[model samples]
Target: MQIYNFSKDNGKKIGIFNSNFIMSRIIETNKGAHIGCMYLEENGIIGYHQATIPQLLLILDGEGYVCDEKKEYFKVRSGDSIFWEKNEWHETKTETGLTAIVIESEELNPSLYMPKKHWDVSSVSF
Candidate 1:
């Protein structure tokens, strides 16, 4: 049982992310549960990616869009939370910028996947 504060931790640009963004990790554990705050600058793209465990991104501020492997795209804003099932491929798009809290399991056995060669962005909207 521990209390983690987002504002207390200093953020750093993670190299693993293809996008130009920074994240501040609130909890770094050896077992389950990891939390962090991520910020993406304008026109930044997280790129289609996958996670090992289930992930939930709680939008804290700004706005953005999320798309799944099926090209299912949707808008997200502050206070909204999006969930990605284990190993689910997804991507984020931001025209202005975005800030959100990312939560996932620390014992992640991630298996990344390649994105589809072709897709229509206007295929889905919400």
Candidate 2:
């Protein structure tokens, strides 16, 4: 089994317009699992994006609002976990700096359900 230290992982900026959000890949497929950590600055927005595999977001600190294509929103904070279905459009609104761990499967194939032209952010691969 592979292990990862999220605190030691260096986060990289993946978005073109908003660079305040940082993402660090903790574990990769080569390690037998996929995991990562995301840190969003206060007022930072990740914009609409979707993933290939269903993911679980476990909030570690601060608070934020998660929204999807339906415009539905949910308040999240430390100890809260949210599950995002594959191919669903989603975004985040962080009121305070938000830190979270995201777990997904690398074995799953990903397809962008949303049009590329509609994406205001950039996609980063680990």
Candidate 3:
């Protein structure tokens, strides 16, 4: 697993006409992609399981913890994104609730577009 920042701090300002706003590019895929929003209520947990395909989780609000095959939890917050390779074991849980957008596809390549954040986790390998 890897973490990336997609906050406004990393976005580009768009000034079209007289409007001004920041836009953060998420992903662009020519092939079909699976996208969905996840709403985990307080004290919720998404049980550990192997990813069926390359997956990216973009935290939209609140905070939560994600664990890999090693079961070591990593704290994540809004604007933070997590990536997992296909068949990688992972799980997500929260004590104070969290919301995120999940993107899955075989062509997902975040490293090519987003800047990766160094995680304190000992190693991504399990």
Candidate 4:
């Protein structure tokens, strides 16, 4: 077991165009389980991306928009959480910045649970 301090961990650049978003990887898989917290600046956006491992997102602060390609956008704020399966394409747009904790693990791991077809990506396969 390990403890992570988001404020002290330091944030790193994650996006292509804008470098305002910062991500601090709190925990990572040594035995195939991954957990982390990401902090974003106001008006920052994390471009669309997909994960090979399944993930669950727990919103910790601020407000934002979460969306996939096919479905309508959803608003996310503090105390909200969502799950995304492997290969699902998603992105976040924050108007007031946001902080979220992410938990993910290998697909074969029974301890990890993921949503089914959370997004409508065509080519990607998990």
The top-ranked prediction according to lDDT is: 3
Task: Report the C-alpha lDDT of model 4 over 1-126, residue by residue, as the tens digit.
Answer: 111233312446678786667674433455566678999888887778885677666678887877765544676666555556788878777878999877787643222321222223333221
lDDT of 2 by residue, 41-119 (tens): 9887778788566665667888887776566666666645565667877777786789887778644222211111122
Candidate 1's residue-wise lDDT over 41-119, tens digit each? Answer: 8987788888677776766788888887776777666645566778788888889999887788744322211111222
Q: 3 or 4: which has the higher TM-score?
A: 3
Q: Which stretches of candidate 3 lie over 4 Å from their true place?
A: 119-126
Which residue runs of candidate 2 sit more than 4 Å off their true CA positions?
1-32, 106-126
Residue pairs clashing in model 3 are none
Residue 61 deviation, candidate 3, in Å?
A: 0.4
User: Which is the leading candidate under TM-score?
Assistant: 3
How much is the lDDT of residue 114 in candidate 1?
15
Models 1 onward score TM values of: 0.59, 0.56, 0.90, 0.58
Q: Tens-digit lDDT track for model 3 on 1-126?
A: 988989998888999898799988878887789999999999988899999999999999999888888888888899899999999999998999999999999989887667887676554222
Worst 10 residues of 1 by lDDT: 109-118
Considering lDDT, where higher is better, how would the candidates rank from best to worst? Answer: 3, 1, 4, 2
Q: In terms of lDDT, which candidate is stronger, 2 or 4?
A: 4
